[model samples]
Target: MRNVVIGFLGTQLDMGKRRRWRPTVDLCRTEGFPVDRLELIHDHKFNRLAHSVKRDIEEASPETEVLLHRMDMDDPWDLEEVYTKLFDFASDYGFDEDRERYHIHLTTGTHVGQICWFLLSESRHIPAALIQTGPPRGGDDVGTFDLIDLDLSRYDALQQRFDQQTREYGDLLKGGIKTRNVAYNRLIDRIEQVAGLSDAPILLQGESGTGKSELAQRIYELKLQRRRVKGRLVHVNCATLRGGTANATLFGQRRSFTGQAGTERAGLLREADGGVLFLDEIDALGLEEQALLLHAIEAGQYYPLGSDAEVTSRFQVIAGASGDLSAMVSEGVFRIDLLTRLNLWTFHLPALRDRPEDFEVNLRHELAQAEKTLGIRVGFNSDASEAWLRFASAPGTLWPGNFRDFSGAILRLCTLAPRGRITRAQVVDEIATLERRWRAADTDQNSQLVAKYVNGPVDPFDIPQLANVLHTCQTSATISEAGRRLFAVSREDRKSRNDADRLRKYLAKFDLSWAELNDG
Candidate 1:
């Protein structure tokens, strides 16, 4: 089997052009390289591009069997089916693994063709190269750009370097990816809609814990699916911006100016110039930075740090804020003009407490993720579910930290729990501890004492409230008649109606009755 040169061709119908690698294909032939096969991926928009590429490959190389893989990035992929089809086709054609030559040539159309190429080459431990064709209108070097031939094998020795870089990038995106109450299906719909629109500064408004970053990424991915936006998603957190450091970070400072090593660094905006630029915690950005950002978005231009030349702004800006940016504008803390510009398609993420219906779904998702990541089969029992509901439904039980808090709590419980399964009692104990921490950390200083009391060791003298609760549980003849009660009441209140309500409310919170407790 001669080397099968797999060229993943991406096209843009909106741009009115299809990316053709016939020239690159010819380059391989000129070099006497055995280009045995080709695979073309057309994401929904370009039927003409797909057919054109197929016909061109067939005519150019009679021995090279061209395979067309149809996909819509908006639709959920069946990974198993895709894998089966790909390998099956290769098998039928007797594709030799050793002879697999993958060259990712990005045709002249839209931007996302690069990512499509990345996806194909990453499927196997094979070599790949990326090249740009002429611009959408056609001509040499019109769409031409520098090429990056990725060497995956080098990544093994540079794991720490890449891990550190990726982690730093992810940290900047933390505020955006935080879990919230937005419906998953609705989010997907919004992403697809955003992809079709042109030059809109998207405003993703939500509470502190809502996942705006993930939605921003979804928007980027969906746009890339269109074949127009080609660059990778670059995230920036305005909150973490420091004085005198912001400009240098956004527009790379000259290496010679600071005498730093390595080639000139690219800012997030420049790196994602042709794709999506996610601005998280945009509310935290300084007035000057905000002005610059507005200019970049409105005029499609920016001045690099320590440079007199102006650069074209080719990226789509998606801004995220935790609170009401409009109100901030009114208060003069934020620029009204900038706010108006960014508030193009605003989406307010609801808090988790407002979406009680999503509790079960969120819990199941978190647990499954934990099992997969940690290689553990931890599970919850009926009682644990009841306990979780009690906390999830409580008046002050708002998950301020959102899904992140929930995930952390679950991970701790799974690690601390016994081998069999976690029970309601265990969950209740964890919730109590978590509640205490939240209270202590909150702005209200009065809550500190309450939080301390709940977390501290229980002593009879510490709280008279426990004595009142005991009196109600013990003196209820209805509870006694249901079953033999175990706890002895403090001699404080044997016949208080108010006491009965307290006991009843507590039991109701856990979906249990006084009779059930007495039965135990």
Candidate 2:
């Protein structure tokens, strides 16, 4: 097997044969174990030193290809930066594990560099065995080396933990197996591992209908299975938390004192004590409430509306936001520090439109669910199944609603199928029905948008005409300006050029004046 070595060039790597031997030179010269390649990474500051080491290795073993790469990092002591650069370099380069067996040389460079190499090897980013070199044992110029293959399975505790967590995730999958999406399943696996390992706050970000709420519930269920949590999974929609009532609802209401609102019962935080708390649309939380929530997360203590004694709830907060909290933070709508606390583990659920490949699988899963819920087993004939697949999996079909749309399609199919088996005709009718429904909804939405300009109701049938007229008027600053715009195009062809009067006549057609639309 061809052995490839990856490591950072140390300050002592090129030390001549005074008291010790060089790792690169010795590894290449080791008897009966020829290294096919030595990939040395170093900063630009070590350009001359790197060149000298490369020459020494070449001289020691002309067969070994000593490929030197210049890595960009400001500090060798910065573990994050060093690890990131090395990981990126390994990813960008052709480090194909199928082509060669690799070894990570951890003996050279700073201690931070060695640790980064170890982590990269552990994570399989380097896809190599970690090799640590020691001083020559026989007092010769060569050194002794230890090669460690970082296979977690070999470690009983870690392997068992991984297996147990994976099994728990598989259990969670049972509750929402509406699709066989590989990417999504892999995401679930990662989430399962994170959920098992940490109860730290998790942030779920995705568009609407991406199943964030369901996933959060499943995570809670898995935790329950593992006995990680001891209380109920308390969920609260932050969108509903508005005004003074929002604070009382979240933190707890104070008992009534004349002319004051009293919250005698426990709030969401208290309800979720020692359990999982899911906050949906977390961005909707007001600034003051956000501060209190932040304090709760940090200190696990908060005062109720009317009480001075700080009530406590050791709740594991999983906040969900439909949009980017960072953007909101930039706009001063969200607290940066609070976001930073929740940002530790953020998972983005992708929209359904991007995963069309899983449509058929999801279609079947949804049907299975319908079978249980509707109390009737439904089967799709060959032709109907094929037809549905064509429309559902087609690139042009935008499933803007994601999984929710998929479920809705199944609902429509199940509701319409009079017989147990679905036929091609039914599929055609349903597709047509959905198309018309979506188009009408789109048109209605457009009409409603146009309606925002009018102070009073306009004829719904005339929305298209009114929209066209309003769009044209917006092209110019005033009625006269708009009139000139229209006349500019047609004045040459018209017998009489009365621009403003013509504009006035058009406005009269819509029962609207220029001032009405442009009142800023």
Candidate 3:
């Protein structure tokens, strides 16, 4: 394979002192690593120097071919301009990997140029290994040269730095909480990669309060930190956009349409130009809005309400959905095209009940947040801490509202704690309040289920017990499992171990049968 060396013509280094040889000329005369062709990149101002270097290279190694490529740069230190120019040059260059091996010389350019070269090579924009040249250490004028392959996995230190960076990105998304849930951590890792690497529309699917909005904001912030975005993050809850005004609110409306003397409004889409648009509860968007959004996302152009001129807003979308958008599309309530675009990078955040392992970590985080907000450092007593953990980590505990419910509980505990100390009494009280709130939210749905079985209106006192029993029955695989769970404390005392029969007897009170319930 022919060896092709591409580098910037070092104006000062190539024009060396009286005794020293030019680095480029010396590189051509390298002992074993022979350069078949040297592609020297320089500006118009250094044309004479480039020619002189080429002449010296030809004299040093008569077999090597020297090609001068002119790349004009107002400032070689401007990373963006230098990178773009170099990228264009590399793109235009005819590269044949089968016949020619490429090497990017890093010793010639400015530090900024060197960085751009490294980025381009590492990203495989230029299919080449980096060749760095240094001054001669001994009597050999060719100097010492090192070949650095762009494959990062070959270097343990570089790989470790990348791994650390990935972890930091995950941590940022997690609000600095060191979550121990294996599945959640893996999900965060994938999200971190997608957030940094791609601008494709991201669909965050999870139950309400599962940190979808928070994760979207964090993704925007991460992109901003990486300089991937310039404009601010525009957050809009699609659920809030309703009625005829939804169209005007999202895509903007002219003052003439409003029939008022006010400035034209640039809607959420335009507001998010050059940045990110976080549409929380995106499934709530009407069909018309969804179609318009799809067009904007795909074409980067959309017409505002009552406007003929199409406005362009090239923004990345991080959509949040609590409900199943695919199911909605099946039902003809959602646009399949929009869902298809958004589904390219979908991440489902697990519910709090599903990730019990992260309870303690999130608990501590919420406590710290509560302390900061309340301006008081509250500490839980040993017994209180144990009680809190036990209740939160219980098998039957259901966190329907996920982190929001958990955070609210912690805030309440901190708020109600006496003298900045939460004792067992406070823990017990908070647990009761949480259980009551959760049960109250389920009462209406559970009551309807109970009403279907019973002949008459159920007593308010028996409703909670019946609701719990019905829920257990619906969720359990078999009658025995439900019975074992429901009568767990009392079953040990009973000599007869017919749990199914016991469950049947209990259900018989409301004229409900196991087979009938399961069949229904």
Ranking of candidates on lDDT, top first: 3, 2, 1
- lDDT per residue (tens digit) for residues 59-155 in model 1: 7667777776665444324554444444454445443447564565555323443444455556643346665444324554323333445765566
For residues 281-347, could you state the per-residue lDDT of candidate 2 as single tens digits? 9999889999999999899999888777899899887889998898778668899999999989999
Candidate 1 lands at a TM-score of 0.50
Query: Alpha-carbon error at 253 in model 2, in Å?
Result: 1.6
Q: What is the lDDT, from 0 to 100, of the residue 334 in candidate 1?
A: 96
Per-candidate clashes come to 6, 1, 0
**Alpha-carbon lDDT of model 3:** 0.89
Question: Model 1: residues >4 Å from true position, as ranges?
Answer: 1-188, 196-199, 256-264, 444-520
Cα lDDT of model 3 by residue, 222-281, tens digit:
999788899989998898888988887788988877678874677889999999999899
lDDT of 1 at 146: 38
RMSD (CA, Å), candidate 3 to true, equals: 8.6
Which 10 successive residues of model 1 have the least lDDT summed?
482-491
**What's each prediction's TM-score?**
0.50, 0.57, 0.70
Worst 10 residues of 3 by lDDT: 17-26
Ranking by TM-score: 3, 2, 1
Error of 3 at 411 (Å): 0.7
| lDDT, model 2, position 27 | 78
